[model samples]
Target chain A: MIVAERKPIDEILGFLSKHQKIMLLGCGGCVTVCLAGGEKEVGILGSELAMARAKEGRPLEVVQRTIERQCDFEYFEGIRHEVKDVDAILSLACGIGIQTVAEAFPDKVVWPGVNTKFLGVNQNVGVWAERCQACGQCVLDKTGGICPVARCSKSIFNGPCGGSQHGKCEVSADTDCAWALIHDRLTRLGQVDSMREILPVKDWSHSRDGGPRKLVREDLTLESGK
Target chain B: MSNGKDFQPKIVAFCCENSGWLAAEAAARLELGYPEKVELIKLPCSGKIDVLYFMKAMEKVDGVMILACQKENCKFLKGNERAKSRVLQTQRLLKEIGIEEDRVTIQYLAANMGNKFVEIVQNMYDKVRELGPNPGKVIK
Candidate 1:
């Protein structure tokens, strides 16, 4: 899911200074799963803002609404009327949701309430770790389910470097050597021979180096004449 | 605790939708007034209550009560069970922070028990009134 964490209170307060009536929009999709921008979080942010404003003796009017998914237009439609009245919107969705809100409402000022961290899964209760980098490549079949691009601190393509010491990365003694994990995992699955095939240096041109990427599937597109 | 001004304890209650929340709504419908001091927030399941929510509530209110479905009857299978664990975790955190554990309370109730909901709210109000305003808030 799109993992996120709340921004500092001062930063949030700064964004709200100009707006007397503000709405906090929470997404129930990835943000809810990560427990960052859910209904509960909306309430907390609203209450915190209220308290802070009350302290300053400048009580602001704040309302909260949680939609099913902020990424979709249908869910965004639900709050269209409500959004018109508020001076500003504090989006509690991921980066995508924030952008979608901005695009959907060109006139209304939108502020991000949470920092979109990374694509990750909950390691356990309250612990989230990076799992995928979405580097426009899929090599999970060759390696184990883990992606070295995310698990490795350096995003190394091949196996462990010389910096690996006792199965731990030299960068951080606590972090596990991602390549070593892949090597051990491949050996257990009898795919050790695949490792000998020299992996050519990765081409940076196809990735984010060339700027934003777009995929167009001709078969899925509808011709204008049709 | 009587002063010249009427004392209304700041109590925040998190009620599970399957049980406690419905109970509170039912109690309200029946005109069974729970303590006016208690402000209730409903969750899909008490298990879904985040630690951040709990921490924020502790800062703003004098007392908190997490109301979940009765043991062995949670709609989400083990939601009530999970809520119990989180409540315990929050209790320890509050204690560690030097706030009395009694400031946070947890209870299990079936959705139909409107009377029980009122009783719980009244008990929470009384407890919080004794504690008075949150010490952390007072310090600030």
Candidate 2:
């Protein structure tokens, strides 16, 4: 899931200082699972804002709402009427959701309340680590299911770098070397010979440098006025 | 409605179904009188109480408590442990906002302790009375 953390409260308050009436938009998908932006978080933010406004003696109104998925237009349709009266909006969703709201409400100022982090998983309670870079390729099969692109500090695709010592990365002694993990995993699976294949220079053009990417399912495109 | 006397504190208790709530029910069945000041909210497990739930409850009440099973009897293994951490987090938040940390508490109890349930609630009532109303309340 896309892991994210809430931005500092003071920063959020600073953004809302100019707007007396604001709407807090939350996403009920990835941000929800990560406990950053969800229905519950929206309520908490609204209450905190209310308390802060009361303290400042400059009272402001904050309305809270959560969409099923802020990335999709259908989910955003649920809040069109609710957003009509607000001077600005604070989106608790990921970067994609924030952009969608900004695009939908071009005139209104949209603020992000959460720092969108990497694609990762919960190692345990309150611990989320990056696991994927979405590099437009998957070499997990060749590397014994360990992703060097994300797990490695340097994102090394080849053998362990000189920085690796005793299976740990030198960047952070607590972190295990990605290549070392791959080596152990391959040895366990008897696929050590797979490392002999020389990998081509990765084509970055396909990943992020390709300029705003899009996926179009030709048959799924809706007709106009439908 | 206030009769010009100071507001009475609102107390909310989140009772774990397997233990605290069961004890509460048993106390009621046995005619053991607990303070009416505390309202009981039953949860499947205490660990299910998220940070938002604690925040929301604190907003609505002056005092909040989580009643969980005895440490050894926790069916979910770490549910009691998780509840304690969240309760501590809520306490810290309350204190940071100028609210008294004593307003929120986590109490572990045995399921069959009818008399003990009454004692725990009465203790909460006394503590909240001493603390008075919530600092977040509008003074007007």
Estimate how well candidate 2 is docked, as a DockQ score: 0.29
- For model 1, the docking class works out as incorrect
All candidates' TM-scores?
Answer: 0.70, 0.83
Candidate 1, residues A1-226: lDDT per residue as tens digits?
8899988777888999988899999999999999889997787667667656655557677878999988887788888999999999999999999888888899999999999999998989899988888787777876776688888889877768889989999899888888888888888888878888767677766678868998888888888823
lDDT per prediction?
0.81, 0.84
lDDT of residue A105 for candidate 2: 87
DockQ class, candidate 2: acceptable
Worst lDDT window (10 residues) for model 2 chain A?
Answer: A50-59
What residue runs in model 2 are displaced by over 4 Å at the alpha carbon? Answer: A52-60, A209-226, B1-7, B17-36, B44-48, B75-78, B92-98, B111-115, B138-140
lDDT of 2: 0.84
Off by over 4 Å in 1: A223-226, B1-62, B65-140
